[model samples]
Target: MPEPTARVEPDEIRRWLSERAAYYLERPVEELDPGAPLAELGLDSVYALTLCGDVEDRYGLVLEPSAAWDHPTLDALTAHLLAALERG
Candidate 1:
């Protein structure tokens, strides 16, 4: 397993998440809205799972599979991730 990166700010997480979601959606990051539901932007379950894996690998986090469903948006997800990191 890879070591976690340095502590990251919420905006950084949000930007990273937007880029990842954009990649999964096959769109530009600029097209993504932080407040918009990722599912509505076409991030299906498979992508969500992949995203969870990415988060785990990047942040060394053990997240529930339903994390994306629970957070639902880039902003919400970023906040959750930031909180998780801070708790560590």
Candidate 2:
């Protein structure tokens, strides 16, 4: 794990996740719907796993591979990450 940094806000995480998901979907970050399900936004299992890795690397926190499935949407996932960071 990486060293903890300053506290992070949900919007920042949301934007980062949106940008990442958009990259995997080959879409613009503006095209992403924060309320939409990741799968519905065209993120498959491979993309999910890739995203999980990205989250770990970016946030420096260990996470279950199923974190995406558990959160399901950008909004939910952002909230989950915020909570996790708080607990961190």
Per candidate, the number of residue pairs that clash is: 0, 0
* lDDT tens digits, residue span 10-72, model 1: 888899899999998999999999999988999999999999999988888888999999999
Off by over 4 Å in 1: 1-5
lDDT of 2 by residue, 1-88 (tens): 3357678878889999999999999999999999999999999999999999998889877778898999999999999988988888
Lowest-sum lDDT 10-residue window in model 2: 1-10
Query: Would you list the C-alpha lDDT of every candidate in the order shown?
Result: 0.90, 0.90
Clashing pairs in 1: none
- Cα deviation at 20, candidate 1, in Å, is 0.6
Off by over 4 Å in 2: 1-5
| Highest TM-score model number | 2
